[model samples]
Structures are given as C-alpha cells and as structure tokens.
Target: MTQATAADAATFAVAVPALGPDVRCHVLQPGRPPLFIEPAGERLLDRAQFRQWSRTVRPALDALILEHGGIVLRGFPTAGTEDFADFIEQFPAFDGGYAGGRAPRETISGRVMEATRLSASVRLAVHSEMAYRRDYPRRIAFFSRKTAEVGGETLITDVRHLAERMDPELAGRLATLGSRTAINFGPRRDADDASYAHMDERGWNQSFHTEDPAEVNRLCAERGLEPVWHEDGSLTVLNALEPFVVHPQTGRKLYRSILHMLPQVENPEQDLERRKRQKYPTGATLGNGERLTDAERAHIDQLCDQTTYSWPWRDGDVMVLDNLQVWHGRNPYQGTRDVQVALLD
Candidate 1:
C-alpha cells in the first residue's frame, strides 16, 4: 500500500464530514430543543483513538456547536471525573479552570470542578455563565457523573431565540436600559460558620480568593466591578453591562444579561421584598439604576420557560454549550444527582 501524503492529514475530509461513524451520532427528536449527540459503537475509544478522532472532527463539531448553542455527547467512553477532563483537553483554548464565578464550586482537578452544591430540592434558574463579569467564559461543558433516579433535567435554552421571542416592547426597553447586578459578599468566614446564616451566601474572601479587602477591591476593579464596603465588613459589588451582545462566533445578537439564580415565587408583586429580604437585596436592575418591576421580571421568566429544553442526564454523558448562545439552569429533583462543570475561555 502506498503512503498517503502529509496534506491528507491536514485536510482529512473534502466534503465536510463526508465520512462519519468513526462512531455513530444521533440527534434528539426533530422538534426537541437541545441537540443530543449519541456516539454508538461496539467498543469505546482508547486515549489515543479519542485524541485522533478529536483532531479529525474538530472543525465539524465546532460549527455544529456554534450553530446549535449546545450539544450533548452521550454513551461515550468517559468513565469518571479525570477521564472527562482529559477528553475536554482535546479542544483548544480550554482555560481548564472556573475563575470569576459567583456560585460556589469545588475544583475537582486541574480542569474539572464539582458542579453546584445547591440542594436537590433547590432550583438554579437559567442564566448565562458569568454574564455580569467583564471577563467571562465563551464556552462551558457539563459531565454527568451520576444520574438521578427521578426527574432532574439540565435546562438549556437558546438565548438568541429567547431574545427574539420576547415581547418587543420589553426587549426594546431592556436593550435601551441595559442591566446591573449588585452582589454582596461577606468578609472571610468559614464555609460552615454559624454566623453566615444571616450573611451572604458567598463570602468576599472566597469569591475574590483573598482575605485582604484591598486585594478584593483591586481584583474587582480590574474586572470592571465596582466595590462598596459597608460598616458591617461586607462588600457589595455592582456590575453593569449591555443587555444585548453580539456572539463572537456567530455574529448574532444574544440575550446577555439576567438576574441569576434568584428564588422563584408565586406572586412577584408582593414577593419583590420577599426576595430582597431573602437574598439580602441582591437583584438585577436597569443600567441607570432603576429596578425592573416584578411583573417585568416575571414576564422574562415566562419567556425562558417557553424556550426551556432538557433531558434526563445519563452517566458518562457530556454536554458542551456556547455560552454566548445558550443559558442553562437546574431542575428540582428528588434523588441524588452528580453533575460536574468545566469552563473554557
């Protein structure tokens, strides 16, 4: 047999993935919201085989993810936390760390982190990852270490389409006003300190990785976050960014801001204070500093629900999301669930 030229390696396929089934790929139901990629084959890939396959399909997979927002790769050879992070390393520009994120996360390895620790009964609302920060990741990946026996779907929705589907009047108002998020972080405190029950959910020392208030201020300023220190040894951070942003990859307008992970209520008209009281006055407001009416926020929440899509997590499943185009959330579940996240810049 004659040896193929080096050029054959650079551009392996001419017709853009004319050759497939290096493992089988499956999409979700035709009308379903989230794209599912199930690689079906008799045997799983060894490390070398997975690396080779990654280089071969990086182009096609990149295009597909940018176009679809999020895609799930199911039934792969991923066996555990370290193995999942290794698979993600094949892709380029993976920062391999979750930096500047508000929600608490435990670093499981160099590139992998334990997913949110929120109780199964609690719900994490749909929002873009670190949209409040000036420096935010462009990509996020999730791995299901274990699936809950009962209902727990990782909610995902297209932010661009969500923006389009929103009521024009509300959308226009948001675009004109933009949005601001005020996050208050307490001073350095033990994670299980009894005093924290009355303090912020996350402490400033943890968020900024420093016990020195001056260092926190410096870090916040560098990231376009304005910090105000209170007499009670707590810091309130305010970040205001455009509500609409152009996706770097697709050049399409995407819904870029939202009040994240707030507790939902039956009636917002009376519950605004309830949340304010419950969350220590951490809520989103207009760029000019006017509050978004509870009604308006409720409407936005409804639009998100209209577009929400998810499926039951299966062990060894991996999901990659284009952060600019997709917003993700957690669904309330009954049994135990283990989902891990890795963010890429």
Candidate 2:
C-alpha cells in the first residue's frame, strides 16, 4: 500500500465499523456544526490492535482533531477484566489516573486502577474531582469494567449550559465572588484507643494566597466575602472574576468557569480552623479571589444540581468527557468496585 501524503492525511478517515445511532460526534467548537461519521457496522478494536494503530495514526489523529475539534472513538474492546493501561497510553487526552498533592492515604495513580475501583460511594452528591486545585484537569475519561449490582450511576452536567441559563444577577454575583477551597486529608477521627491517637496526620489548606491582596480584595469585595472569621476559627476569603478565554482555533468563548469550592455554601472556614487547632496536618493555598453569601450559595447549588448528568456503568464501557465543559460524579452502589485513572497535560 502507498504511504498517505499530508493532503491525504488531512482527509483520511478511519472506518469505525461498530458505532450505533445513539453515539453522536460533535466538533466541540462553534462556527461549523459537527460532521457525523457513520460507521459501516459494529466492530471492536482490542488493546493490541489499538496500540498498533496509534503508532501509525497518532499524527493523522492529531491532524483530524485540528480540523474537526474532537472525535467520538467507539468499538474498543472491553471485558470486566482487560488491562486498560495500554489503551490509555494510546490516547493521551483520555488517560484515567490521579495526580497527588494534598491527600496521601488514597493517592490513585493509573488508568487500570481508576477504572476498577469505586472512588466514592454512589449515593454521595455530585462534584468535579480536584476542584480545589488552581490547575485542575481540563478533560476527564472513565471506562466501566463492570456494572453496579444496584444503584451506581454517573452524573454529568454541562457547566456552560448552567452559565447560559443563569440569571444575570446570580451570574454577576458569582463572577464577582470568585471562589475559595479548604481540603483536609487526615482521618475523620482517631481510633478509640492510644494505638491510633496522636498519629502523624496529613492535609492541606487552599485559599486566595497572593502577593497582591488588594487586587484579590477588589475582585471579591462585591461578592460579599470580606474575609470574615468563622465561629469555628477559620477565615473566609472570596474572589469574583472571569476570563474571556477564546479558543485560538475555534474563536469561541470556552465559558468554563465555576465556584467549585462553594465557599459561601459550605462555610468550611470554621471547620477548617477547628481542624487546624486540633493539630491536623495541612498544606497549600490556590485561589484567584471571590467569596459567597447565603443567597449566593443557594443559587449556585441549585444551578449545579440542575445541570448535572450521569453515565451509568457497563462492564466494559469507556466514557470520555471535556473536563472544562462537563462536571461529573458517582452514584451509590453495592459490593466491591474498582476503577483506574490517568491525566494528560
């Protein structure tokens, strides 16, 4: 077979023989709408095959994305028991794993691990993982190795949708309030006896720590978060701001902003201070300024809840999402569950 040229590569299309009507592909940008790539039939690409394909097609895949924004990869092999690390490495943007900083007890580190374990209980409320960090991931991917015995479900919310639906007054308030977050990594409580008492604990604190407090202050003042000390001892700082980031290639606003810390709603200051006085370990502060109030807190929660969506687990299903645009969470489940994860810069 002859090698394909740049022009040929630009127009090259991979024949996906195993996608259904329910699976849709979107260009992930504005201007031109998404182009549908219909598969000839349902087909599955195993790990070895996918790896081999990546070796020769990565460059072409990159070019395709440059021209089309994104692609919905379907027909990948899965078994409740297949090794996924190889497949994850083939797709850098869809690697499932954890990046550790604050939490030491349960630092998740690879695609296979993230794929098989239950990170949090399904009944737990929905939240974006690692929202407290300043440089959080911009994309997320999950592969279901097994379905839950009972009520496990995955929910996803398009934050952009929320932004569009937001009341102008509420949006203005949140934009002005910015956000703050305090993370704890120590045991919830010590064991009953001395055996566990006085253990060397670990944790971290993340707030708007910057060289210019005035600038931070100016950004959050209108949000009503003026560095108030909580009865529990922690202090609350807020930053309200927005970036009009335009996708260089697409020339469209990304509209990916949120008050993930939910400072005004959770009021972690008091609890955080109490934990500090208790001598628990902690580290780091990441913020851009902004605070919240009771009213603002309620509004934000309502908005997030309304925008949330879920991806139910199947024994061998892989789900990929635009982290910047989609918010995800887990549903309650029964019995043991396993998951693996990885991240790409």
The whole-model C-alpha lDDT of candidate 2 against the native structure comes to 0.42
- Per-residue error for 271 in candidate 2, Å, reads 7.9
Q: Evaluate residue 68 in candidate 2 and report its C-alpha lDDT on the 0 to 100 scale.
A: 36
Candidate 2 lDDT, 143-186, residue by residue in tens: 56656676666666555445666567765654554444433323
Q: How close is candidate 1 to the true structure, as a TM-score?
A: 0.84
Clashes per candidate (backbone, < 3 Å): 0, 45
- Alpha-carbon RMSD, each predicted model: 7.5, 11.1
Error of 1 at 97 (Å): 5.8
In terms of TM-score, how similar is model 2 to the real structure? 0.56
Model 1 residue 126 CA deviation (Å) reads 1.0
lDDT of 1: 0.68
How many backbone clashes can be found in candidate 2? 45
Error of 2 at 241 (Å): 8.5
Best by TM-score: 1
